[model samples]
Target: MAATGFGALDGIRVIDFTQMLAGPFCTQLLADQGAEVIKIEPVEGEDSRGAGPFRPEDELRAFGGYFASVNRNKRSIGLNLKDPAARDIALKLADSADVVVENYRAGVMDRLGLSYETLRERNPRLVYAAIRGFGDPRTGNSPYSEWPAFDVVAQAMGGLMQINGPDRFTPLKVGPGVGDLFPATLCAFGISSALLRVARTGKGQFVDVSMVDAVLALCERTVHQNSFQGEIPHPEGNRHPLLSPFGLFRAKDGFVTLAAHFDAWWVKLAGLIDRPDLATDTRTATAAARVANNAFVYEQLELYTMQRTKKELAAVLGGKIPFGPVNNVAEILEDPHFAMREMILKVDHPGVDRQVAIAGIPLKMTETPGRIASRAPMLGEHTDEILREIGVGIEQAESLRAERIIG
Candidate 1:
């Protein structure tokens, strides 16, 4: 059979009313799959465009890496939804789209008269998705629904930070913006599910994802540990609570992680280290015993590993065992795996002379592969063409421009 052209979502159109990470990331996933994602932003642009990491040489600093990274493969339209005329234009766009996704607080869309109920009246088959700090009241009422939250806040409240530090007394938020991103990932899945149902039944549904709930779901082990064990799971440093060698290890140049947790692998690892006695020692024999003496186990492992470089360790353990070096961004750029898998991409930046590196699509489908359709658009890049497509005359467009409705 022939492979799918462009992407699996070639025919789908998305009206993206997302500004920052959570919402934009979700829409970006769809855009990667060849959905015609029309990103609706404020007159200036989306909020992240103002955020930085822009090259010092960039004169047209309208957008930066933070915005460009997640916003690739989408068109941008600048509209002031506070204005009734602009709201009407947004409604038209939403009605025309197969999906509409936003990350505004609970009532923001309702205030703008672009609520799901309002749009579903015109397009019953439109999938409406929302990402919120707590959640929409329609699904479940949270006491902190009105409170503003970001990635760290969700990580803290969702039990992830509680079990992520060197000790229980010191909690650490993850290095990444997992709170925003995890919810974005889940919301993307939800939107896809809703779209599938819409195709099958010719009916649309509202897909809601709570940011805090998503974080809690991600740290699901924390819940069962407390319930089943009658004990709270504490910060585990870098090692597993039950497994012996399932976490990071010290190395000469950098760190590496090894996972010789099972008995077979453990014995092999002991033999590799020329410490056969470790396999027979009652203190470090089985998985349970190793866990009981984890501190002693790590100290002994470090005595051997601390003398070798990350590359040297990889040479010994690369495919023979579940081992990986803790690489930074530079190492990742130099690694062959990312390039071979197409996980790192170089896309043209609007003003930058050189091509900028952004992440490539992860969902590899044999029949319908995802692809980057285009680089991220400039602010209001397609306003004229989009207005023309929506049947607005030149004079009418000029009037909207005059009124600061569409940028």
Candidate 2:
């Protein structure tokens, strides 16, 4: 748990009705910024609690890394929403919330009588946000609106996979769950924007983000290239389409990325590699000329870089050009820059003997910086506390628990 301190979103409260990566990630951001987030889970618990990379010593194995990483700094309340009593509790929570976020498939919330339209009538100032696979018809209808989607499906359908691999024929899904995460990020932004409007006009609006649409937005360049140049973009290995020397190159020990896209940086890079002649040569003098002779340019650059270690190349090019050593997880854990910025944090996890390091908040504020306040909750860890806070008597809470309505 983090020490007591005020955060940017100190007074705002969020009712999180989300599970898995996309929805949890968005609400986690809000919680990190000090929103009082109440995560309402099913009686059986959120599915991500079973995801692994678990601590071997933990006998119970209540939750795993996947759940822990995104769920820090929030309280959990497990309620069986299928039960009418539990659904009523959820509605009451929403009635007092500043923001309500969910990522269920279309119509699931409506069927439970907890849809945005239903909640808005009781709390008109609610900022309701949804992150769905194909989005809701309230904004725009999609043919795949009712279809289920995961990260891979979104990547494949949204044109990201088509441009992500070594060649056009071999498509690759990105290693990270960006398809879910990007939409979550956009939805978080939308919620913040809507909250600002609510403060100004006292009216809240629906904010919808689709996984496919978010991935497409990330690859917007492809759409314009196809429309304007009549060219379907293909995977160009590690190289950029229009920029020369703007991608990865093999080194003696590992790989390094060099991005000398502009002429001045290109000239400096050529000089640093002891090939000043290439800086003035007609074949590679300007950005356009370099792109025209990309094969020869990359070949010559690789010839010089392949003989040097990543460390040796970094010594010469680190600060001068946009150059970086391609680092894996182990390397990143030891990198000084990441340490300096507090991007790697050691967080305490229950039932785990040692502290676990997770990625830290990226947003830094002078007066009200975000922080990791607490570990992910145990299953229904705060159920009774939350119910009591919301005016449910202890006897009623126990009765609900006995009936398996609240975990």
Question: 167, model 2: CA deviation in Å?
Answer: 1.4
Q: Judge candidate 1 at residue 280 and give its lDDT.
A: 95
> Mind giving the per-residue lDDT tens digits that candidate 2 earns over 17-113?
9999999999998888888889999888999999977988977788989999999888889999999999999999998899999999999999999
Error of 1 at 123 (Å): 0.9
Which ten residues in a row are the worst by lDDT in model 1? 1-10
- Which pairs of residues have clashing backbones in candidate 2? none
Compared with the true structure, what per-residue lDDT tens digits does model 1 show for residues 93-116?
A: 987999999999899999899999
Q: Which stretches of candidate 1 lie over 4 Å from their true place?
A: 1-5
TM-scores of all predicted structures: 0.98, 0.98
